[model samples]
Target: MEKKCINCSQRFNCRDSYISWLFFIIGLIAAIAIRSVTFLMELGDIYAKIAWYLGVGGFFIFFVYKFRINHRRSRFIKANKLMEKVSGRLELKERDYEWIGSLLCSLSAKKERINYFVIFGLSALALVIAIYMDFVR
Candidate 1:
């Protein structure tokens, strides 16, 4: 599918859309692991231990992915010389604009909306459950 760059009006196919599921799962695991810790702890020590493990594992995976993406973005910035150019001057050239537009386009992911929605929903549910478990019990 061709997506238009909002800044440059250039049409390009987003290749990473399919890979966003991996991001969604990682985020889901991390969110669930974090919110479930206290609730799981109330259940039993073994369950609390399991939740801790899941939380730690999810954090590790999330950070690794974050670092990798940051490194890739750093490389892109270095290769494009965007930092130096922007720091030295206020006006960006046509090529710089195109590159920035491409970067923005690449950073935009369609699945992020749904991912955030699901995460927020899960968090709300977890909060309600926590409240019920703590005070309503």
Candidate 2:
């Protein structure tokens, strides 16, 4: 079934939250695999291995959380916009809607960037610890 936007009365394809959930699950599995490989390879001492596993897992979990938040926010924004447009109380131009959509999308993208940096910072710290243990020990 086609989904209608709440603000703009525009009919467009909508993403299923289930798909996002699936992605999160897949990421978790990938994180586990990475940790397993690190353990098997004996990349470092026990502490270092633990650090690597935590780094990878934490990164994936952060990514999933950020993705889910942005996805839901965009969906809600789009739905609200569609509803506004269909109700015809405000009489917005097509360009106006386009601009608003672009603005919202960009904001979401910015949020992703912020989240990624935070994740990267944590992962980097973990990696540094692993490296120190492996080489500086």
Which candidate leads the pack in lDDT? 1
Q: What is the per-residue lDDT of model 2 for residues 18-85, given as tens digits with 9 covering 90 to 100?
A: 75455545555445444444334555467556655665766577576767777976686686675577
Q: Give the TM-score of candidate 1.
A: 0.68
Pick out the ten consecutive residues of candidate 2 with the lowest summed lDDT: 6-15
Reference-based lDDT, residue 24, model 2: 47
Among all windows of 10 consecutive residues in model 1, the one with the lowest summed lDDT is: 6-15
lDDT of 1 by residue, 26-97 (tens): 877877787787789788989978877886788688778767877998898999889998889868888888
Model 1 spans with C-alpha error above 4 angstroms: 1-12, 17-20, 86-95
Task: State each model's CA lDDT, in order.
Answer: 0.75, 0.56
Top model number, TM-score: 1
